[model samples]
Target: MKGGNMGNMMKQMQKMQKKMMAAQEELHEMSFESSAGGGMVTVVANGKKEITDVQIKEDVVDPDDVEMLQDLILTATNDVIKQIDDKTNETMGQFTQGMNMPGMF
Candidate 1:
């Protein structure tokens, strides 16, 4: 009886793993956008947590104060990353729901 139960459990686990992999693959095609400095700097990141592109307004460029521009870019990138992280947790949380696996997601 225990052996049969274990086989069933393994099958269930395999199904769950497939679902999780599908979800992750979907995330790879998703994109998140964020802007900083009143939209002067914009960043687009994909679900892979990679920054796809960045756009900087010409008016925001200041050769005398490069630090400010750098700050804006940094802020935009951080925001995009945060967005990806939040979405990943929300999507992947479903699989781990009710499972006491800390840091699994």
Candidate 2:
């Protein structure tokens, strides 16, 4: 009886692993965007936590205030990184809904 239960648990684990892999692939294809300093700076990042692109408006670029622009870009990039972490948690949390595997989390 115990052997049969172990087999069933193993099958469930395999299925969950497959689902996790698929979810990770989907996440890689997703994108997140963020802006800072009243939209003067914009950043786009993918689920892989990679920066896809960055843009700055002409009006916000000041030769003497380069530090301000740098701050805005940094803020925007951090925002997108937070967003990716949130998304990853939301997507991966679904699989570990019930079972508590020791040392896996």
lDDT of candidate 2 over 1-105, digit per residue (tens): 699999999998899899999999999999999999999999999999999999999999999999999999999999999999899888988887676865432
Q: Which regions of candidate 1 fall more than 4 Å away from where they truly are?
A: none
lDDT by residue (tens digit), candidate 1, 14-63: 99999999999999899999999999999999999999999999999999
Report the number of the highest-TM-score candidate.
1
lDDT of 2 at 80: 98
Q: Find the 10 residues in a row with the least total lDDT in model 2.
A: 96-105
Model 2 lDDT on a 0 to 1 scale:
0.92
Per-model TM values vs. the true structure = 0.93, 0.89
Worst 10 residues of 1 by lDDT: 96-105
Q: What TM-score does candidate 1 reach? A: 0.93
